[model samples]
Structures are given as C-alpha cells and as structure tokens.
Target chain A: QQPVQSPQAVILREGEDAVINCSSSKALYSVHWYRQKHGEAPIFLMILLKGGEQKGHDKISASFNEKKQQSSLYLTASQLSYSGTYFCGTEPDNNDMRFGAGTRLTVKP
Target chain B: DVKVTQSSRYLVKRTGEKVFLECVQDMDHENMFWYRQDPGLGLRLIYFSYDVKMKEKGDIPEGYSVSREKKERFSLILESASTNQTSMYLCASSFLPRTEDGYTFGSGTRLTVV
Candidate 1:
C-alpha cells in the first residue's frame, strides 16, 4: 500500500527549514527518501532501516520509526535548489516498495 | 556510476495501439521496477522483476504487462493504449530487496495516448 504524506505542499524562504512526514498503514522494513525536480527523474536521498535510524545528506536528513510505520524528512537551511517534490518510499516486510503521494516544496529567495 | 536508462523520453500513441517502454540498468541489479507517475498520485508500480524471466504484478498492473528476457533490460508493455494510460513512466533498479542500498532511477518516459 502507498504511504500518506502530510503538508501536501509547503513554501519556504532561503535559509528556512521544513519537515515532511510520511505514514503507512503497513509495517515497514525500511524507508527511502527521494527528491524530483520538475521533469526530472527522482533522485535517491537516503535510506533508513532500523527503528529510529537517521541518515543525513548535506542539509537534508531523514528518520525512520519502524514501530510507528512512519518516516520524516528534514530539510535545514533550504536553498532555491531544494525546490522540488519529496517522496517517501516504504518497504514492507514483504520487500515491496511503494511511494507516497509526495510533498511539493518551493524554496524562494 | 550506476545507470538506469529508459529507452524513450517521450512517446505519443493512438488509442488501441500497443506500446512498449524499455529500461536498461548497467549495475547488474537484481531487481527492476516499472512505475507510472501522475500529477498528484505519485508513482504507482505496474510491475517488477527480481530476476530474468521472473515478473510480478505491482499495485496497478491492469492493461499492462512486462518482459524481462535479459537480466539488464526490463520492458513494460501496454496491451492497448488508451487516453487514461498517458503518464510519465519511470524505471528503477535495486541491488537487493529491502536492502540499505537505494534504487537507481531512469529519467522516465512521458507517454501520451490519444
């Protein structure tokens, strides 16, 4: 099943921070984060496996709560380049991965 | 660098016509997936293959089929193209299932059915 993402859309100014959340109805084995700019393929950001596991990529980081079947992505000091759609891919115990609807983030100057 | 390449970037087909979308991964990944991306629906999986000659239907597989004759190439086939089938199709490959390694995605093909 596909996960549900909150704050379908968000707007931020440069140097601001934003958080996107994803929740799934099924138990999760791992969670992956990806960002896609307009007309571009989604790019992998990070993958979190164990409960409470957190991984960071520059100003972006994500945490997975296996128990809660949820994951959250944190974008710190956002830049204009950060404007894109963020998707969370949830992998259940069955090893099937499905993506959330995604959160549109627009970073302005 | 690992690369997942989709054969077409854009395609336009008439209704009732058959269409094929090809994907190739050079990383020797064991898992390949086909997904269609829509405006607000996100990416919906149509089919996936874990090995050559093996395929599984994904979340949305109706009106679609897949081929994995070779380990590196995966193809998604539309039995009969319809207007509703128009969308951006994406291909991805992963080294392992439920592994820490993230998937490598292709640029995607924008298909339009008239």
Candidate 2:
C-alpha cells in the first residue's frame, strides 16, 4: 500500500525548519527517505530499520515509530539546498519498497 | 560511489512503437528495480530483478515487462507504447535486504509517447 505524507507542499525561508510525516497502514520493516530536485533523480537520504532506530544526515534527521507505523523527517535550519520534493519509501516486508506521494519544499533566500 | 546509468535521458516514441529502457549498475548489486514517476502518483515500481535471468512483477506491472540478461544490466520493455506511458522512468540498484544503505537510483529517462 502507498504511504501517506503530510503537507503536500511547504515554503520556508533560509534557516527555517520543517517536518514531513509519513504514515502507513501496515507494519513497516523499514522506512526510507529520498529527495528529488527538478528534473533529477530521487536521491536516497536515510533509512530507519524495524528496530525503531533513528537515522540522521547533517541537518536532516528522521524517526520511525514501529507501533504507530509512521515516520517523521526533520529538517533543521533548512538551507536553500533543501528545496526539493521529499519522498518517504516504506518497506512493509521483504524487498518491496513503496514510496509516498511526496512533499514539495521550497526554501527561499 | 555506486553508479546507475540509464541509456537515455529523453526519448520520444509513437503510440504503437515498442520502447526499451535500459539500465546498468556498476556496483554489482544483487537487486535492480524499475519505477515510473507520474505527477501525483509518486514512484511506482514496475519490475525488479534479484539476479541474472530473474525478474519479478511489482505493484504496477500490467503494461511492462523486464529482462535481466546479465548481472549488471536490467531492462524495461514497453510492448506497445501509449500516451499514458509517457512519464519519467527511474532505475535503482541495491545490495540486499539486510543492508541499510537502501537503493541508488539512476538519473531517470523521460519518455514521451505521442
């Protein structure tokens, strides 16, 4: 099933913060985060495993709640480089990975 | 760094023409995937391969077929192109399920069926 992502689009100023949430109806083994710039491929960001682990990359971080079947991506002190469409890919089980509709973030100068 | 390359960045084909989108990964990963990205649908997996000569249907595989002749190459074939098939196609590669790095994707091929 496709995961649900909150805030279809967001606009922020430089150095602002934003959060994108993803929720799935089924139990997820892992939740992956990716970002795609205009006309570019989606780039892998981070992945949270089934053990309820959290992952971070510089100013980008994510937390997975196994019981809630949800994941949240936190962008702290967002930069202009963060302007893109963010997608959360959920792996319910095995090797299959399904992505969310995506959250478009535009950070202005 | 792992490199996943798609044969074309843009392609145009007729409605009834056969289209082939090729992807090659140099990392020798065990898994390769083909996905299509539409405006509001996000990335939908069309097919995936675990190894050479092995293929599996994904969530949306009705109009597509896949081929994995060698370990590094995975191909997506559109038997008969349609206007609905005009979208951005993406390819990805991964090591295995147990790993945490997840998938490395190609730049994508923007295919247009007119």
Candidate 3:
C-alpha cells in the first residue's frame, strides 16, 4: 500500500522552516526520501534504516520511527533552492518500496 | 559519478504502436527498475530486473514488459501504446539489498501517445 503524507502542499519564505510527515499502515524497515523538481526525475536524498536514526543533507533532515511506522522530513532555514516536490518512499516488511503522493513545497525569497 | 542514462528525453507515438524505452547504468548495479509517473499517482513501478536475463513484476506490470540482455542495460517495452500510457517514464538502478545509498535515476523519458 502507498504511504500517506501530510500537508500535501506547503509554502514558506526565506529562512522559514517546515516539516513533512509520512505515515504507513504497515511496519517499515526503511524509509527513503527524495526530491523532484518540476519536469525532472526524482533525486535521492537520504535513507533511514534503523529507528530513531536521523540523517541530514544541507538544510534538510529526516527521522524515522520504526514503532510508529512513520518518517518526518525537516527543512530548516528554507531557501529558494528548496522549492520542489518531496517524496517519501517506504519499504514495508515485505521489502517492496512504494512512494507517497508527495508534498509540493514552494519557497519564496 | 554513477550515471543512469535513458535513450530518449521525449517521444511521440501513435496508438497501438510498440514503444521501447532503454536505460543504461554505469555503476554496475545489480538491480534496475522501470517506473511511470503520473500527475497524482506518484511513481508506479512497472518492472525490475535483479540480474541479467531476470525480471520481476512490480506493482503495476500489466501492459508493460522488460528486458535485461546485458548487465548494464535494461529496456521497458510497451506492447501496444495507449493514451493512458502517455506519461513520464523513469529508469533507476540500485545495488543489491538496500544500503545507505538508494537508487540512481535517469533523466526520464516523456512519452506521448496519441
């Protein structure tokens, strides 16, 4: 089944911060995050395997909660370059990875 | 850098025509995948190959097939094009079993079926 993402769309000004959440009904062994610009393919950002582990890239970071079967992506001090759609792909116990609908983020300068 | 290359950036085809989308990866990854992206559905996997001459069906495999004749190349074939098949197709490659790194994707092919 596809994961569920909260706040389908979000807008922020420069230096602002936001968090996008992804929740799955099934137990997840891993959660992968990716970003995609308009008219482009999705680019890998980071993958979280163990629960309670946090990974960061630039101003972006993410955390995975194994017991909750959820993951959250954090964008700190948002920049114009961060304007894009972010997707969370969840790997359930079956090991089949599936992507969520994605959260469209627009950062204004 | 690990590079995944798709043969075409844009393609136009008529209904009922056969379409082939080719992808090549230089990272020597063991797994290659084909997926189609639509407006709201996100990415739907069509097929994947774990090894040369080996293929597996993904979530949505109907109306699509795959071929992996060489270790570095994988092809997605649309037996008969339909209007519903017109979308952006993406190809990705990954090393066997998930590690820290994830799949590397190609630029993608925007196919238009009329």
Candidate 4:
C-alpha cells in the first residue's frame, strides 16, 4: 500500500519552518525523501533506516519513528528555493518500496 | 555523478498506438525502475528489472511491459497506448539489495496519448 502524507499543501513565508509527515501501516524498513522542483526530476534528499536515525542537511532534517511507523521532514528557516513538492518513499522490505502523494510547498519571500 | 538517461523528453501518440520508452544508466546499477507520475497520484511503479532478462511487476503494471536486454538499458513498452496512460514517465536506478540506497532519476519523458 502507498504511504500517507499529511497537509497536501503548505504555504510559508521566508525564515519560517514547516513539517511534513508520512506514515505507513506496515513495518517500515526504511524511509526515503525526495524533492522535485517545477518541471524537474525528483532529487534524493535522505534515507532513514529502521534504526531510528535522524539525518540532516543544512537546515533540512528528518526523523524516522520505528515504533509509530512514521517519518517527519523538518524544513527550518525556509527559503524561496525550498518551494517544491516533497515526496516520502517508504520501504516495507527489500522487495517493496512505494511513495506517497507528495506535499506541495510554496515559500514566499 | 550517476546518470540515468531517458531517450525522449516529450512524445505524443494516438490511441491504440504502440509506445516504447528507453532508459540507460551509466552507473551500471543493478536495479532499474519505470514509474509514471501524475498530479495528485504520486509516482506509481510500472515495472522494474533487476538484471538482464529479469523483470518484475510493480504496483501498477497491468498495462505495461519491460525489457532489459543489456546491463545498461531498460525499456518500457506500452502495447496499446490509451489516454489514461498519458503521464510523466520517470526512470530510476539504484544498487540492489541495499534497503537504504537512494535512487538516481532521469529527467523524465512526458508522454501524451490522445
């Protein structure tokens, strides 16, 4: 089954922060995050394994909650370049991986 | 940098026409995938090939087929194109058996079936 994402769309001002949530019903082996700009391909951001690790790059960070079978992406101090669609791909096991509908984010300067 | 190349950037096809979309990966990755992206539908996997001559059906693979005759190439075939099949097609590749591996995606082919 496909993962579920919350807040289908978000609008933010510069320097603000936003959180996007993704959850799955099955035991998640890993969670992958990707960002796609307008008319561009999706780019891999980070991957969180089952070990409950929190990974970050610059002001973007994410956490995987193994117990809840959920993951949240945190965008701090949002910039204009942060405007795009964010997708969360969930892996139940080595054989299956699926992505959510994606959360559209628009940041205004 | 790993590069996954898709042959056509845009294609227009009539109903019932046969369509072929090709992808090539220079990274020599073991896993190649074909997915279609639609608005509000995310990316739906059409098919995936792990090795040459080996293919697996994904979540939405009923109307699609794949071929991997060589290690660097994977092709998706639409036996009879329909309006519903019109969408942005993306090709991705990654290392096999690595649950945490991040996929490298191609620029994508926007196919329109009329």
Candidate 5:
C-alpha cells in the first residue's frame, strides 16, 4: 500500500524551518526522501534504514521510527532553493517501494 | 551517478491509440518501475520488472502493461489511451534491494490523451 504524508502544503520564509511526515500501515524496511522542482524529476535526498536511525546532510535531516512505521523530514533554516515538493518512499522489503502523495513546500526570499 | 532516460518529454495521442513510453538506464540495475504522477494523486505505480522477461503488476496496473526484453531498457504500453491517462509518466531504476541508494528517476514523459 502507498504511504501517507501529512500537511499537503506549506509556505515558509527564508531561514525558517519545516517538517514533513510520512507514515506507512505496514512495517517498513527502509524509507527514502526525495525532492522535485517544477518541471523536473524527483532527486534523491537520503535514505534511512530499519535500524531507527537519524541522518543529516546540510540543513536537511530525517528520522525513521521502525516501530511506528513512520519517518519525518526536517528542513532547518530553509533556503529559497528548498522550494519544491517532498516525497517519501517506503520499502516494505526488497521487492518494491511505494511513495507518498507528497508535500508541497514553498520557501520565499 | 545513475542516469535514467525517458524517450519523450511530451506526447499527444488520440483516444484508443496505443502509446509506448520507453525508459533506459545506464546502470545495470536489477529493477525498473513505471509510475504515473497526477495532481494530488502522487506517484501511482503501474508496473515493474525485476529482470528480463520478469514482470509484476503494481497497485494501478489496469490499462497498462510493461516489457523488459533487455536489462537496460523497460517499456510501458498503454493499450488504448484515454483522457484520464493524461499525466506525467515517470521511469525509475534501482539496484537490487531497491532501498539501498533509492531510485534514480527519468525526467518524465508528459502524455496528453485526447
């Protein structure tokens, strides 16, 4: 089944912060985060394994709670370049991965 | 970096016409997937192939079929195009155990059926 994402859309000013959440009904082996700009393909951001670890890169970070089957993406001190849509993909196992509906984020200058 | 390439950036087709969308990946990934992106609907999986001649029906597989005759290429076929199928079609490829590094997606093919 496809995962669910919260907050369909959000608008923030430069240097602000935002959070996007994704939850799955079934147990997840891993969670992937991606961002897509207008008229472009989605780009991979990071991946969190089932070990319930937190990973960070630049001002973006994510946490995966295997027990809850949920993952959250944190964008700290958001930049204008961060304006785009964020999607989380949940992989129940090695066979397939399903993506969330996505959250639209707009960061203004 | 892995590169996934889709044949067309935009396409227009008439109702009842057969449409083919092609995807090629430079990396010899073991898995390839086809998804359709619609407004507020996110990415809906249509089909996926794990290896040559191996196919699986995804969540939304009706009206869509897939072909993977070779390892580097996977194709999506619309038996009879309909207006409702007009959307952005995305192709993605990943190594075995897809969650490893995540999927590398093609730029997408925007199809408009009339």
Candidate 6:
C-alpha cells in the first residue's frame, strides 16, 4: 500500500523551515526521501532504516519510527533551490517498496 | 555516481498505438523500476525487475507490461496507448535491499498520447 503524506503543498520564505510527514499503515523496513525539481528526476535525499535513527544530509534530515510507521523529512533554512516536490518511499518488507502521494514545496527568495 | 538513462525525453503517441519506454543503468544494480508521475498523484510504480528476465507488477500495471531481457536494461511497454496514459514516465535503479542508498532515477520521459 502507498504511504500517506501530510501537507499536500507548502510555501516557505528564505530561511524558513518546513516538515513533510509520511505515515504508513504497515510496518516499514526503511524509508527513502527524494526531491524532484520541475522537469527533473527525483533526487535521493536520505534513507532511514528501521532502527529509529535519523539521517541527515546537509540541511535536510529525516527520522523514521518503525513502530509508529511514521517518517518525516525536515528542511531547515530553506533555500530557493529547495522548491520542488518531495516524495517518501517506504519498504514495508524485504521486497516491496512503495511511495507516498508527495508534498509540493516552494521556497521563495 | 550511478547513471540511469531513459531513451527519450518526450514522446507523442496516438490512441491504440503501442508505446515503449526504455531505461538503462550503469551501476549494475539488481533492481530496476518504472513509474509514472502526474500532478498531485506523485509517482506510481508500474513495474520492477530484480534480475535478467525477472519482473513484478507494481501498484498500477494494468495497461503496462515490462521486459527485462538483460541485466542493465528494463523496458515498459504500453500494449495500447490511451489519452489517459499521458504522463511523465520515470525509470530508476537501485542496489539490492539493505544497501543503504536510495534509488537513482532517470531524467524522465514526458509522454503525451492523444
């Protein structure tokens, strides 16, 4: 099943922060975060394993709670380049990987 | 860095025509995936391959068939194209499960079927 993402769209000013949440009905083995710019491919951001550890890449970070089947992507001090659609892919088991609906984020100057 | 390459950036097809989207990965990954993206719908998986000649149906695969005759190449075939199938198609590849890295996606093919 596909994950559910919160905040279908978000607008932010420079230096602002935003959070995109993804929740699943089934337990997840890992959660993957990606960002896609206009007319571009989805770029990998971070991956969180089921161990409840947070992964960080530059100003982007994510946390995965295996027991709760929840994952959140965090963007701090948003930049203009941060404008794009964000997607979270979850692996419910060893073989199945599914994605959420997505969150459109626009960061203005 | 892994490179996932899609054959075409844009394509137009007529209704009832057959459509093919190709994807190739240079990273020798064990998994390849096909997904379609539409506004508000996010990315919907159509098919995936784990090995040469191996395949699995994704969430939305009714109108799509997949071919993976080679390890590095995966193809998505639309048996009979329809206007409703017009969308951006994306190809991706990743290592086996538990590799700790996310998928590498191709630039995408913007397919418009009229």
Give the C-alpha interface root-mean-square deviation per candidate. Answer: 1.0, 0.9, 1.2, 1.3, 1.0, 1.1
Return the top candidate by lDDT: 5
Choose 2 or 5, whichever is better by DockQ. Answer: 2
RMSD of 2: 0.9
lDDT tens readout by residue for model 2, A1-109: 8899998999999999999999999998999999999988889899898878888899999999999999999999999999999999999776788999999999999
DockQ of 2: 0.81
Candidate 6 lDDT, tens digit per residue, A1-87?
889999999999999999999999988889999999888899988889899999888899999999899999999999999999999
In candidate 3, position B58 carries an lDDT of 91
Stretches of model 1 off by over 4 angstroms after superposition: none
Those runs of model 5 whose alpha carbons end farther than 4 Å from true positions after fitting are none
> How large a fraction of the reference contact set does each model reproduce?
0.79, 0.71, 0.64, 0.71, 0.71, 0.79
User: Which one wins by lDDT: 5 or 6?
Assistant: 5
Candidate 4 clash pair list: none
Candidate 4 CAPRI assessment class? medium
- State residue B26's C-alpha deviation in candidate 4, in Å: 0.4
Between candidates 3 and 5, the TM-score winner: 5
lDDT of 3 at B72: 100
Once fitted onto the true fold, the runs of candidate 4 whose alpha carbons sit more than 4 angstroms away are B99-101
For model 2, the stretches where C-alpha displacement exceeds 4 angstroms are none
Q: How many residue pairs clash in each candidate?
A: 0, 0, 0, 0, 0, 0
Per-residue lDDT of model 4, residues A17-85, tens digit only: 999999999899899999999889899999999999999989999999999999999999999999999
**Candidate 3 Cα RMSD after full superposition onto the native fold (Å):** 1.1
Whole-model lDDT, candidate 1?
0.93
lDDT of 1 by residue, B80-102 (tens): 99999999999999987555678
Task: State which candidate, 3 or 4, has the greater DockQ.
Answer: 4
State, as a TM-score between 0 and 1, how close model 5 is to the true structure. Answer: 0.98
